[model samples]
Each structure stands twice: as structure tokens, then as C-alpha cells.
Target: MYMSTILKIAVRNLTRYTRRTLLTATLISIGVIFVIVFGGLASSFKNSMINVITGSLLADIQIHKKGYVESIDNLPLNIFLSSEETAEATKIISGNPNVVASSPRIKFSAMLSNYAQTSGVRLVAIYPDKEIKTCPDLAQRIKGRKDLSSIVNPGEILVPELLFKGLSLKLGDEIVVVATNRDGAVNGVTLRVAGYSEGVMGPSGKDGYIHIEDATSLLRMEIPEISEIAIKLKEFKYLSSSYKKLADTINGDTFEVHTWEHLTPFSTIVKIVDVLILMVRVILTSIVLVSIMNIMMMSVYERIGEIGMIAALGTLPRQILSIFFLEGILLGLISTVVGAIVAVVILTILTITKLEFKFGSMNIALTPGIPWSEMLITVTIVMVISAIATLQPAIKASKLEPVDALGHV
Candidate 1:
């Protein structure tokens, strides 16, 4: 039989049972919509997280002592660079044109106390001037103060809003911060509460800031010795080149370079997203398989007489098979196209309204638009499943003896 003849019979047979065909097609469409909508949402969330984390805490790249990261939880000051080593590392890093700004930090954990309450806090000592240029948003999030430009006093600190609210803290409150120094000696500082700022999203792990000078004095840090360097690039496009370039130029086994993704633990959420997508694919594919296969099997039973007549009239068994296969493929194409359009329209509306929600401590804005690649892959899965589901019935119909099918009621 001609290809056109098989298609005509397939479409005609579909229209003969209009309601059933529509129902099956609708189920497939729903599955497609589920995959596309959920996939788009996962992508949007990851993008929002990346923007927030990379913009502040993670920056673009980081430099740290080789063994320091492996035992980062201890705040191991012993693994840190010496004053002369830090200066040399700074010189090599600053030589790169890709570097826009770099800031040195000393990160430590301390117990902060006001007379009435005490809370354990992570403290990041920053060079206020350099950090301001590096993270401009930090300047904007300053609550009580207009900006972070001035060093009002030596022991002033900026607390996160969450911690501030929990501790019932007020500006100009004198607080005591206690910690163990690198030499395993007890150290403490009485610092004035400066102001509050929005918390950073990534792993700088600093809920509060004091001047680098203040930290050095309090912790007895050597001159020019610091914990790590946070680096920003002129453009994000420079990330790959700069990471390799800086590593080669620094040329030291004592230090390791890392990107923001490696620095922030939250980045592991990307793997979680992948697992979710895979589960979704399995669910939607199951829907297509069961729904299409069930409908096609019913179609075979109802059309047995017609199938017999066509075969008896000298139409080949392969031709009979082609007719059913074409019907399933056409149904898949129609449903997938409709479902994709619906998904795009809905996603667009949500994006335009700028729908947002908070998950845990992070705020996420639902970004608009789907990646065409994701949609294409999902539709392809539906089509492949449709082919497989229809194949079993198609094969059964092809093998049916004309005399036996004609004898059916």
C-alpha cells in the first residue's frame, strides 16, 4: 500500500472514534506539560541561586592555602599563608587583567554576647575599602549605616538581619566576641555593634564583619597574613581563562584556586535538580506508555473486521502495520505541539508577573522562558514511547489471519 493510503486510513480510523482519540491525545498532552513546566521551574530556581550566591559571598574565584580547605571547619589559622607569602600571591593575582577587584579576609567562629543573650556566630574580617568595591550590594544592604566606607571604630561589626532580630541587638551596643587563636590560645574582643546587612547566600560563612586590622589584633594575626582572597572578574566570560591563568601564574603547591561553584555548598543543589528531572521523565513516559498502549489495543479490537477486509483485499501485512504505527506517531506529534504551546504561554504569564517565593533562607524569582533544548528532548521521549507502545498492537494486527479476523463478531 502507498504511504499516503496508510496515513489516510489511520486518520480516518482516529476520527471514527473521535471522543476516545481526543481523550488519549489529551493524556499525552498533560504528560508533556508536566515535564516542561517542572523542568523550567527547576532551571529558574538554580539560576536565581547562582545570581545571589555568586554576586556576594562566592564572588567569581577564590584562593586559599592548600590544606586549609580540607580542614576548613576548624578555621585552621596554622595552615594560612605568612605575611611575605600573601604579598607575593597578591602581586601575582593582581597582574591578571581579568581581575577587577580582590579582597583579603580572615574568617573565624566566635561567640557573640550582649549582657542578656549569647549566640555563636561566624565572623568574616574584611578590608572595608576593598570589600566595598568587590561587593557593591553589601554597601546597599547596610541597614543603620548609609554605607560601609568609614571605619567608625576599631571593633565595629556588621551583623546579619536574621541574627540581629534573634539576638535583640541594637546599634552601638557593646558586644563581647570570644574565640580561640591560631596558637590554641583563648582570645576575645569587645566590639561595638555597627549595623545590620542582608546575609550572603554562599559560603563566605560570615554572618558578621570586623575590620581586618581588628581581627589581626584580636586574634594575634601576623602582618599581611589572612585566611583567603575573594576575587571578582571584569566579566563572567573570563572565568575559565582566569582560573587556569591564575593557577599557572601563582605556580605554587601551597595554594589552591577555586570557582564560586566549588566554594559554595549550595551548588550541590544542581545535582538534586538533575535527580528530580530524571524522576519526572520516568513519570511522564509511564503516562504516555500506558495511555497510548491501552487506547491502541482497544482500537485494534474494534477495527478487527475492517483490518480483515483490508488484508483480504491483498493489502500486505506490513501495510496493515504501517497504518496503526502512523496513527500513534501522528497523535504524539499533535499532543506534543499543543502541550509545548500551553507550557510556553503559562510560563510567560508567570514570568511577566515576576512570581517569587522563599525557600528556607533564600528568595527565588521564577524566571521566564524554557530552554528549547529541554523541550525538544522531552517531546522526543514522548514520540519514542508512542512508537514502542503502538508497536505491540501493530505487530499483533499484522500477524492476524484474514479468515480468523473476518470470523470475529
Candidate 2:
């Protein structure tokens, strides 16, 4: 028989059992939907976390003195760049045409007391004018006091509501902070709760913010110094090249460059999301493979006498095998196309609806963003697995003897 005749026969055979063919295709398409939806949600979540972290305080890039990152938990002010070194580093960073802004931070660990109760807290003393520009989310969320720009009043401090509730401290309340200075001398400072600020980080709820000058007084150094400098670029895509230019311009021995991901522990969450995506695809593919194989096997079994008759009439066994293979491929193509379209429609609706939730301290919106590459990969996996799954059943039909197959009840 001609190849055209064999293809026509395959189509006719598939059309004879419309429900079974539709059911098999639906199963394959469902797998595509799962992969696409999960891929989109994971990507959206990672992007949200990045925005929250960077918006809170971490700019596109950070410059730290050598050994600061390793000993950061200890509040290692000893490893910081002194006033003179900070000036030189600032000049190098600000020289890059891509650089947009920069701010210096002195982070330290200190104990706070309401005079009635006491708790340990992570304190950051930052320049208000510079911090407000890139972290506007925080600027908009400030409550309790009219102004947060001036921390010059030694006794004023900013605390977030998360900690505000825990401390049982109210606005206009006073808190005392005590800490060991860089020289190992214990020093104390009194601060009045001046305003409330918010942060996306889980720890930010209990963290305290004060003026850089006050931090200088608390951490006590003869010379002014900062733990790190945060730099914002015109576009984050230029981070690598911009970092290289700044690094080469500065003394490498004294300064090290880091992106936001390297500076924060949040990268671990991004990794876990990625792993879940991979595992999900693996599991979904197995389900698809089994469904397609079972459907094809039933197709071959129900038509044993038909296969025998076709073979007896001189239709090649290879042709019989081809028929089953073509049926599986056709089902895969139909389902993949339909599934992709359905997934896209649903994702579009989700984006418009703006489904949002807060995970930990970060507010994340399920922004509908499906990668075209991921969609293509999903279709390819379904088609390939569908073809592979039909092999055993196709081979069984091909190997059948005409006499026995003809006798099949």
C-alpha cells in the first residue's frame, strides 16, 4: 500500500474512537498546563523577592572592605574602610557613568531597653536623604512621626511596627541602647522612638535605625568609618561591567564588590524554588509518559484482529508500527497546542487580577510572566515522551503473527 494510504488508514482508525483519542490528548495537555503555570509562578516569586530585598536597603551593588562579609555577624567595625578610604572608594564608584546613587551604612548589634524591658537588636545607622531615594516603599510606609530625615537629635530612633507591637513601646517613648564600641569599650546612648519605618525583610521588624553620627558616637572611633557602601546603577543589567570598572579603579586589596544576591541570605529561597520547579517537571513527565503508553497499548490490543487482517492483506508490519507511532504524535501535537493556549489565557487573567500574598515579610504578587523558552520546552517534553511511550505497544503490534492475531477474540 502507498504511504498516503497508510496515513489515511491511521487517521480513520484514530477517528473511530474519538473519545479515547480526546482523553489521551487531554492528559498530555494537562501536563503542559502544570509545567507552564508552576514555571510562571516561581519566576514571578523570585522577581518579587529580589525587588523587596533591593528596595529595603540593598542597592544593585555593594562595596565592602576586605573580610567584612565573613565577620559581618560579629559587627566587625575593625575591617571597615575609614573616612579617608571611603572618600577614595566613593570617587571611583561615582566616576562610572552608569552609577546613579550611593549610600554608606554602619551596621552594629546593640541592646535596647524601654527602661521597663530590654531586648537585643540589629541596628543600622544610615543617611536618611540617600536612603529615601531608592527605598521609596519604606518612605511611603513611615508612620508615627512627621519627619524621619533628621536623626541629628541624639535621642530619636525609627522602629518598624512589627517590633513596635512586640516591644509594647509607643510613639514618643524612650529606649536606651548599649553596645561595645569598635575599641571594645561598652558605651550607651538614649533614643526616643521618633517614627515608625517598615521593611520587607523578616528581621527588619525588630531592627532599629539611627543617625550615622549617633552610630559614630555609639560605636566610638577616633576616625570616621563605614561598614559598607551601597551603590545603585542606571540599570541592573549593567551590574557586572559596572562592578568591574569600579573594582579596577579602586585598590582591590582594600575593597570587594558584591551584588545584592551575594550580600543577603534570601538567595537560598530562590534556589529552593528552582529545585521545586525541576522536580515538578520530572514528576509530571512521568505521569504523562505512563498515560500515553497505556492509551496506546489499549489501542493496539483492541485492534489485534484488525492488525492481523491488515498484515494478511500484505500491509507491511513496519507500516502497522508506523500507524501507532503517528497516532501518538498526532495526539501530542493536538494536546500541546491546545494546552499552551489554555495556559496562556489563564495566566493572562491571573496577571490582570493581580493575585497577591505575603510570604514571610515580603508582599508578593503572582505576576503572570511565562517564559517563551519554558513554553517551548514544555511542548517538546510532552511530544518526546509521548513518542517514546508508544514504542513498546507499537513493537508488540509489529511482532504479532497473522494467524494468532486473526484468532484473537
Candidate 3:
């Protein structure tokens, strides 16, 4: 009976001060909205960023020869290992279950020229089958639509559409590729342009691709000491574990096995930003709790005389506390529900619009959109703050002596 009476009193007081109650709730709602919007967008962006780098560009892991980085761009032509060692490494990588596929790559700076035009390009020599498995996007492009995917023979090359435009070259146009051979000889190979494309390296380059046989012939070497080895994993979540295992298995004192994160330093930086975002949410929630505490304190002051009357009529001090405490909890619960509804409606509209952004000179990855986990976390924080904020006022109201409270009136 006492509990019922306390709850009724809480409801009556909340109804009577609707304006003040609503104003406090509005502040909490704003904080909740911030969490939902940022959290969802952040998750989306992270996923896109990972896909671009690992899926098309870097692969999950890369193995490199010692001292290769120092002179990779302007390589002094020389073979580093026998074909046997290269074969051994490939076999080891293929046998690992964690490794989806591995590809051998040789990258060199070269000048590709037709009789009338010339352009600089990064010549990458890769096996057709392995390359396709490593970069499915490249295979999809070559298989149809563009007519560039029809070639199965060596000596055929693919040039990005950008390169084609800049060089004024067309399909089947013969071009000369000049680079240093493994024996320090300046070797040149004239080959037919097998295809034209635009995926060589983002926006502005005369970048082109070639088959492994062509690369071997042009460089005058069986294997031109791989500057990079690309590895795909079974899944992204196991990347760290995979990285450690690869390092242990392929433990060469002269080389380093690097995860995509090592190849692209910005991934670590983005994770740091994620941590900072969570901290900011924590600080904002603290501010909301302070506001709630102030509002509850004011409610207690206004009801002091009424509380004293109830106590004099044999109402326990604990019952007086329960009324104020229940009111705070109700306020929190309602605000959380309303905030969630607003967040969902707003997020749904924004997602349907498919918002996009293009940064200066670069195509920014599209935002990933909102997530439900973010909304739940935000609502949870708000409700917890509400409960915590009421504790002080509830205790004070419960401990006040009936005589002292009545004497003030």
C-alpha cells in the first residue's frame, strides 16, 4: 500500500511539472542522437576503408625481400634467389589453410612507348590465374564488357584507360617496355597491347600491367627477386593471428612479413580516432548526468513542505524518498524510448538518401550508414545516468526528519 501511494505521488508531481521535465529530457535526447549517428557512420566508413585497401590493393599480408625497399622504385637489376627458393616459398604459402591464395609479384619502374607517344608506368608481372584469384575485380573487368579480358597468351598487356587516353594508343598497338635486366643490362621488349583499362593505380598515371612471362623475358631473368608477395586470408577477424603465424612459419632472418596495416599506416591512426570518439561520448554523458542531478534537486526543494505533511501523517521517510526516486527513473525510461524512436526515424531517412562525399581530387568511400548496436548503447547510457543522478536527492528526502521538515513550513 505504501509503495502504491509513493508511485502515485511521483506520477502526480511529474504531470504537474511537465515543462521542466520535458526540457531535461530534451538535453538527454540530443546526446543519445549524437551517439547513434556517429557510431553508425564510423562503422560504415571503417568497413569501406578496409575493403578498398585489402580487397583490391594490398591483400591482407605482403612478404618482401631484405633491402628491397631501399631500391625498389629504381631497382638495380639483379636476381636475388634461385627459382627453387621461389618455388619453395610459394608451396609453403599454398599449403597453409589460413592463406586463401598467394601471388608472386615483380614491380619495376619502366617507360612504355609507342612510336608517337611515351608514358611512365609501374610494370607488375603476375601469373594470370593467381592474379585473378588475388584481385577478382581485375578478372571481372577482363572477362567481358571491355573486350580486354580475351587474351590468354603471354606478351599481352593491359593498360588503364587513363594511360590509353594519354598515350593515344589503341588496342593491338605495339609498345616498347624498357627496364634494367637482372644482369644490370638495360633490356627492352616490344609487345602488343593486349588490353586497355583504368584500374592501374587510382587517377593519374600511365600505369599498366603485364603477364609474368613477359616480365621474365623483358628482365632477362627467370624470377626478378619479388619485391612484394600478396597473401589473402580466410577472414578479416583472424588477421592478427594470421600475421603472427605467417611470421613464425616464414621466419627468414633477411625478410619481414607485414600485415596490410603495416603496408598502410593510416589504419592504426583510424583506430585511434575510434577510441577518441568513445571518450567524447563518455564526457558528454557525464554532462547529461549533471543536468539531471540539478533538475532532481530542484524537484526535491519544491516538494519539501508537502513531504513534511506526508511524514507527519505517519508516512515513513523511506516512502518519501521512493516517490522522488521513482519519478526520476520514469523520466529516464520515457526519455530513452522517445530518443530511440527519433534516432531510428532520422537514420532511416538519411540511409535511404545514400549520402555521398568526394574529397578533393579523390573519391571518398561512401558512408556505411547507421547500426542498431550504437543506438542501444546510447540509450543504455542515458538511462544509467538518469538512475545515478537521482540517488543523492532520493537519499536526502528519505533521511529528512518530519519535525525539521514541518518546522520550516
Candidate 4:
């Protein structure tokens, strides 16, 4: 009994029950398509959200004082990097090949008064040149500001849209900002409104920007100090490796480095998306397992007489088992190929349509696609489950007695 003969018989047996075979194959194919499409959409959405966070505000990586982030909610001003520490961190960051730009910021909470109304706002004081380079999309988030060269200047402030609308502030309006310094002393400075900034997360965000010089003046600092350093990479794909290298080089008890995922609360949403994907995969596996096993069991029962004839005609038990096993493999292989082709076509259509949806205040377009490795893994799992599903039926057919099988009605 040659392997070719067994395969030919397997094909013949499948065609003999064309309707059943097609139904089983269709079920498995549907499972594959569902998993591929769902996984692709989920991945695209996750990546888009990440890009929004990283590009607009939180750059790919951030370096902060050891305790700065833990108490970030309060915008603590006392725990800051001194001028010497900032200089050292900047030097190390500049030397890293993966870092495209880094901006040192002084963040604090301040009360903004437009003379008629007052609001509490979180202010991030940045050097315009360095900040623009580190967060390229930061300028885009500012309403009516296209020129990145002058995002914010000395004695100027970029206020959040919520604050701008709430306080009825106009460009060039003089606003007084009162803040407490690290020395527990309070000071106030008047600054001109340079522009209105769009919130990164939603409309409720109260983050604003100002010039480092003005921040120092308002805080009454004798020397410049930094709260954090935001770093950008040449590409998002370099995130993991760049983070590892930077952490290895600069992280210590005094300073800590973190990726954008670690710095934002949106990371919890990303994790939930991942768990959903895994659940989809598990459902797909169950579909394949049950469908293949049911088909194989029915196939074995229907061909008992045929099995007895083959066994009595001197066919080897191993050969009979091989035929059933090959049928399962062929069914899995054909269905997987069809499902992959159809999935790719559907994904291509989605990409061409440029499906758009809203996330917060931003309109996001989905670019759904599956990696080759993921597709390969999917195919492998289906085929392996197919073989396992066919095993009991194949073994049972091989062990059937010629007398008992032939006597079946």
C-alpha cells in the first residue's frame, strides 16, 4: 500500500459524501475568517490609539525622577531634577542612536485667572524648539497654529481648549497664572495667550503649555529645574529596543525611564483588547476541534462495511488508518487555504474603503492587516487539531473485526 494510493482513496471517500464534506469544511473556514478579521481590526485600533497618545503628547519614551510619576496626580513641584541632573540626562539621551529628540519639561499645577473667572490647570513648561521636535504632532493639536517654530514664546501660553472656551479667552489676552514653588512660596506672572490647544484624550483635559522662562519666573525659581524628559524615536517599532537600551544606560534609584504605554492610563484599554483577541482565538479553536471530530466520527460509521472489505482483501490496518488520517488533513488544508484567501480579500477591501470612526475627539481610520507569522500559526493550529480529531476514528476503523463489520445491516 503506497502513500499515493492511500491519498487517492481518501479523496474518493470525501467526494462520495460531497455535501457533508463541504458543510464541515465551510464551518472550519468560517471560524478561520472570523478570527483573522477580528484580530486584524483589533490590532489596527490598538495601534491607532497608541499613535495618538505617543505622537500628540506622550512621546515614545519618558525619563522622570524616581518618585515623580507616583505622585503625578498632585503635580508635585518639590520632586524635580536639578539643573546638573537635567544636563547629565540630556547628555546621555543625546548620545543614544535610537532617540530622535528629547524635551525636558517643568510640570506643575497652577490657577489661571482671566480676571472674570479662575480655573485650575496643569501646565507643562517646555522649550519650544526641543518640544516641537520630540512631539511632532503637538503643533497640529494647537488650533490655528501651523508654524512650529513659534509654538510658544517667552511670556506666552498655549491654553487648553476647555480653559479657552470656559474662560472666554481670546488670543493675545493677558492671563494671570499663580503657582507655588518648591520652596513653598507662591508667585504669579501674567502671560499672553498664544494659542488654544486641543486635548489629547478628551475635551475635559486641562493641560496647558508655557515657555520655560515664564514657568521659572512664575515659580520664582533661582535656577532651572526639570520635572521630566519626553523622548521620541525615529519609528514606533524601535520602542522596545530603545526603551531597553535607554533604561540600561540611564535608569537608577534617582531616575526612571518608561515607555508611553507605562505613562498613560489608556494602557488598560490596550490590555483589554488583547484579552478579547485571545478569547476569539480560543473560540476559533473550539469550532475547528468540534467540527472536524464530528465529521470524522460520522465518516467512520458510514464506511464500516467498506473498511471490512478492505481489511479482508489483505489491506494493512495501518494503510486503512492512513487513508482516514489523510482525509482529515486534506479537508483542513483546503478549507484553511480558502479561508485565508477570502480573509485577505476582505481585509484589502477594508483598507481601500478607509473605514473611519471616532475615538474621543479624533477621527481614526482603520488599516486592518494580519502579519504573515500570525497566518502561519493559524494554519498550523487548524491542521494539528484536524489530525488530533481524526485519530480516534482512524484507530477504531483499523481495529474493526471483518466478521462483525460485514454483518452490519
Query: Best TM-score goes to which candidate?
Result: 4
- Candidate 1 stretches with Cα past 4 Å from truth are 83-102, 111-119, 129-141, 148-155, 162-168, 174-180, 185-191, 200-206, 231-253, 257-265
The 10-residue segment of model 2 with minimum total lDDT is: 146-155
Model 2, 243-266: lDDT tens digits are 778877778899888888788788
Using alpha carbons, what is the TM-score of model 4?
0.95
Question: How do the residues 254-285 of candidate 1 rate in per-residue lDDT, one tens digit apiece?
Answer: 78888887876777887789789889989999
Each model's C-alpha lDDT? 0.81, 0.80, 0.71, 0.88
Best of the candidates, lDDT: 4
As a whole number from 0 to 100, the lDDT of residue 193 in candidate 2 is: 89
TM-score, predicted candidate 2 vs. hidden true structure: 0.81
The true-versus-predicted C-alpha distance at residue 296 of model 4, in Å, is 0.5
Residue 108 accuracy (lDDT) in model 2: 85
Cα displacement (angstroms), candidate 4, residue 303, comes to 1.2
Candidate 4: residue 50 Cα off by (Å): 0.4
Clashing pairs in 1: none
Q: List the residue pairs that clash in candidate 2.
A: 155-192
Tell me each candidate's RMSD, in Å, in order.
4.0, 3.9, 4.2, 1.9
Error of 1 at 181 (Å): 3.1
Candidate order by TM-score, highest to lowest?
4, 1, 2, 3
User: What local lDDT does model 4 show for residue 148?
Assistant: 62
Clashes of 2: 1
Q: Provide the TM-score for each candidate, comma-separated.
A: 0.82, 0.81, 0.79, 0.95
